[model samples]
Target: MTIKEKINKFISEKKITHAEIGRGLNTSQQNVSRILGESGKVSLDFVVWLACEYPEIDLEKLIRDSDHVSIVRESPATYQKPRLKEKALEEIGAVLDKYM
Candidate 1:
């Protein structure tokens, strides 16, 4: 099914209102309506936020339906301090190398 269709189905099945989703996303109800409406565009950041907020929703399925590759490296809940530090170091090193 198409992304819009899937989202509509999810809305119906979950009995969730646009306002509820808006509240979760810290957006307006109108924005949520627009997001789920025809010609609505989904951003990777929005999808990631949704996936993080609602873990019951299958992110892989959402990504597939949206015709996008799943780029989520790992769930935020599973990110360890060491991993974060390592990533920070890598990013810092990359930036330094770019200048040097």
Candidate 2:
């Protein structure tokens, strides 16, 4: 399944509403609705933010489409800090604080 489909499925399976996700992500309900809308294209940064916010969700599964093979990296982990826009940084930090 595509990332968008996965998000929709996750929402349904968890019985989560857009307002709830918006509260967690520190965004408006309308923004969350827009993000999950039929034509919405989830960005990598947004996926990362979602993972950080809802750690219970399998991020790898959410990110990987069914048609693609999952690659396992044997190399040591490297921390490349994400460069998010100001608004995104604020929202991510707020969401993280709530969970952490």
Top model number, TM-score: 1
| Model 1 CA lDDT for position 93 | 55
lDDT per residue for candidate 2 within 10-95, as digits (tens), equals 67776778888878778888988888898777765667665554445554444444453322223432333453344345545665
Q: Could you tell me how far off, in angstroms, the CA of residue 84 lies in candidate 2 after the best superposition? A: 16
Task: Give TM per candidate.
Answer: 0.58, 0.57
lDDT of 1 by residue, 1-100 (tens): 6656666676777777989888878999999888888888765445555545544455445445345433233444443544544443443355446554
Residue pairs with clashing backbones, model 2: none
Q: Name every residue pair that clashes in candidate 1.
A: none
Residue 33's lDDT within candidate 1 is 88
